[model samples]
Target: MFTGIIEAMGTLTELRRQGEDVVLTVEAPGLDFSDVKLGDSIATNGVCLTVIALGDKRYSADVSLETLARTGFAQAKVGDRMNLEKALTPSSRLGGHLVSGHVDGMGQVMSRRSSGRAIEYWIKAPADLSRYIAEKGSIAVDGISLTVNAVKGDAFLLTIVPHTAEETTIARWKPGHRVNLEVDQIARYLERLLQGGAGAQAPSSTLTLAKLAQSGFL
Candidate 1:
């Protein structure tokens, strides 16, 4: 798991295609891989990729075709900058929300405007993904966890402060730029639990104090 807090930015140094999959070598000069062993997981732009080879300032990983199809990496190229984060340790602070490093879908930046020292951006997510997003909820955009300031249709708004803009790749975002998006993990599981399965009936009415008292649960 991760915290969606970007530790550094890494550059895609090289990509080699092998059948339907590809091998990627990233130049992560800011990351110290001294203790990282083979098969360690790393979050590259919110996608959990296993480290196949560890070097002083570089590491290689294999990206599957499914991952490429679901993430913005389908159009990624060498020299592209990627947000990087190491797996969370037990002692690590939960600075950001829990991130699984699993991209739910791709989102496009619809608009951007300057709001004093902050920048407001509107991102349009996939139609199906819109249901999982909620106002004031947490969402990871391009691997940066941000709170949704508002939600309209299939799009959401975010306010990025100067510190966040400078620490990550959001500074390079534009109106048409595409980014990897990961919705809150809790929301997805809650939906599944509530939906249950066939023949299972969800609560017919909303849970309230009066209803709870009537049901003798309060």
Candidate 2:
């Protein structure tokens, strides 16, 4: 697990394809590598990647085909900056919400505007994932934890402060740019519980205004 708090910014130094999988070399001199070891997990742009090889200030990991199909890494290139975070330890402070580093779906930047010292961005989430997003909810975009300022049909708003832009890759996002999105883990679990857990069949009808009224929930 991860706290979704970005510890350092890394650059994709090399990308080598090996059969169906690809190997990535990331260089993050700013990252503290003193305690990192082989087999450790690192959250790279919201995707949990196992460290296959370690070096002075770099590490390499193999990206499976499943990951490439689901993350922005499909379009990633050398020199691209990535948000990096080490897995949280038991003693680590919960600075951000619990992040599984599992990208649920990809989102696209819909619009961008300046909001005083902060930048306001609207990103369109995948249609199927919209139900998991709520106003004031927590979300991880490209591995950076952020609060949802507001929510529309299939899009959500975020207010990125200067520090966040400087610390991570949010500043580089533009309209139509794709980003890895991981919704709140709690929300996902709650949904499974609501569905009766595990392999239980889904409800025949979704909760709606009329159903809420009938159930005395309105």
Candidate 3:
């Protein structure tokens, strides 16, 4: 698990295709990898990747076909910047929301503008994933944890402060840019629990306030 807080930005030094999988090599000069061993998991742009090889200032992980199909990695290339984060330890603080580093779907940047000192971005999520998003909920965009400022049908707004833009790759986002999106994990699980409850005559997808009150979630 991860906290979706980006530790550093790494440069994609190499992408070598081997059969159906691609090996990604990143140069993380500022990230400490002295304690990282083989099989350790790292979050690269919100995708959990296992470390296959390590060097003094670099690491490599193999990307499976499923990951490439579901994430922005399908469009990634060498020299692109990647948001990097180490897996959370038991003692690590939960600075951001709990992130599984599993990209649920890809969202597109629909619009961008400045709102006083902050930058406001509107992103359109996939139709199937829109119901998981709520106003004031948390979402990980390209591995950066952000709060949803507002939500419309299949679209949401995010306000990025100067520090966030500087720390991650949000500054490079444009209207047509695609981003990896991981919706709040809790929301997805809740939906599953509601749909899979026993003794129900029929499975339901509707979420109601009365149901929340009965479930002690209100």
Candidate 4:
């Protein structure tokens, strides 16, 4: 698990096809890549990847065919920047919203503009994923936790502070660029609860509010 706060920006060092899979290499920034071990999970642009090898200041992970197809990761060229985040420990403070580091779908950057002292961006998301987005709701974009400033059909907008733009890859985004997105964990839980009738009496059980009050269980 992770809090979608980006720790650093990593540059793509190499990407090579190895039979049916692709190996992705990234140059870590300001972070100690020495401690990164094999099988350690790291978020690369909101996509959870297991470290397969560690270099001087770079690390490598193998990307499956599914990842390449679903994430538009195959389009990542050398030197492209990616938002990087280490997995959270039990003692780590969750400065951002809960993130599974699992990219649900790809969203394209529609526009990036200056909004006073902040930077505002618009992204076009998949039609199905649009329902999960709400104004002021938490959303993880490329591993950076942000609040939705507004929603417009299949697209949404968010504001980025200067610090965020400098520390992460938001500043590098432009029209047609793709980003990973993850919805709020609480909303997913709510959906499951409502769908499964969590904590609610089954139909035909006659467990109405008045009945519960009379039963001293209200």
Candidate 5:
């Protein structure tokens, strides 16, 4: 699991295609590599990639076709900057919401505008995932945890302060840019519980406007 808090910015040094998979070499000198090991997991742009090779402030991970199909990595290139975050440790602070490093879907930046010292962006998420988003809800966009200031249809709003823009890759984002999106884990679990757990169909709702009126709720 990850905290969705970006620790540092990393650059993709190399993208070597091997068969159907691609290997990524990321260089992040600013990140602490002392505790990182070959098998450790790192959240690269919100995707959980296992470290396969380790070096001096650099590491390599193999990206499978499944990940490529679901993430923005399908269009990633060398020299592209990415938000990086190490896996959560037992003693680590939960600075952000729980992130599985699993990209639920890809969202596109719909618009951007300036708000005082911050930049406000509207991102259009997938239609299927819209139900999971709520105003003031937490979301992880490209591995950086942020709050949803508002929601409209399938799009949501994010206000990025100067510190967030400087610390991560949000500054590089623009309209039409694709970003990895991971909704709050709690929302997903609640949905499953509402559906009556695994393998159970969603319970049908019998309440309606007429029932509300009968109960004096209207």
Candidate 6:
């Protein structure tokens, strides 16, 4: 699990094609490699990849064909900058929402503008993914957790604060660039289980969970 709060940005030093999979060599000096072991999960641009080898600052991981097919990583090139975040620790603060580091789909930046002290961007996500988009809802784009400001058909607008823009790789993004997107997993699951589900009835059309609990049935 992850918080979607990117710790640092890393650069792909090299990419080597090995059969259907490819090995990625990335350099992230600030990324603590001591606790990382082979097979440990790390989010690279919202895609969960395992650590295949650990070095002083550079590490290598193999990207499976399935992962490549599902994410924009397939077109990743050498020297590409990626948002990086290690798996969450129990003691770590939940600065962002629960992120499985799983990319659901890709979104394209359509337009950009400068807000007061932020950057406002319009991203066009896939049509199927728009079902998960909602105003004030959480979404992970390019590994950075952000809140959706407004929702339009097949697209949404996001305003990234200056701090976030600077700390994450969003500052480096350009219009038409493809970004990995992961919608709020909980919302998606609930929407599915509540509507058109096998036996899920309406999602408790009554009051609230607290009210129900206070009334004795949890």
lDDT of each: 0.90, 0.93, 0.94, 0.86, 0.93, 0.87
Provide the lDDT at 27 for model 2.
99
TM per candidate = 0.90, 0.91, 0.93, 0.87, 0.91, 0.89
The candidate, 1 or 3, that scores higher on lDDT is: 3
**Candidate 4: misplaced stretches above 4 Å?**
197-218
lDDT at 32, model 6: 76
lDDT of predicted model 3 = 0.94
Model 6 regions lying over 4 Å from their true place = 199-218
Residue range 122-214, candidate 6, lDDT tens digits: 999999899888889999998888999999899899998988988888988789999999999987776664454647565455455566569
Name the regions of candidate 5 deviating beyond 4 angstroms. 198-218
Cα lDDT of candidate 6 equals 0.87
Clashing pairs in 4: none
TM-score comparison, 4 vs 5, better candidate: 5
lDDT of 2 by residue, 1-218 (tens): 99889999999999999998899999999999999999999999999999999988999999999999999888999999999999999999999899999999999999999999999999999999999998999999999999999999999999999999999999999999999999998877766755655476665646455665698733
lDDT by residue for model 3 over 1-218, one digit each (tens)? Answer: 99989999999999999898899999999788977899999999999999999997899999999999999998999999999999999999999999999999999999999999899999999999999999999999999999999999999999999999999999999999999999999988777677666566666656766889998975
**Candidate 4, 129-158: lDDT as tens digits:** 898898889999988999999999999999
Instruction: Please report, as a residue range, the 10-residue window in candidate 4 with the lowest summed lDDT.
Output: 202-211
* Residue-by-residue lDDT tens digits, candidate 1, 15-52: 99989899999999988777688988899999999999
In terms of TM-score, the best-performing candidate is 3
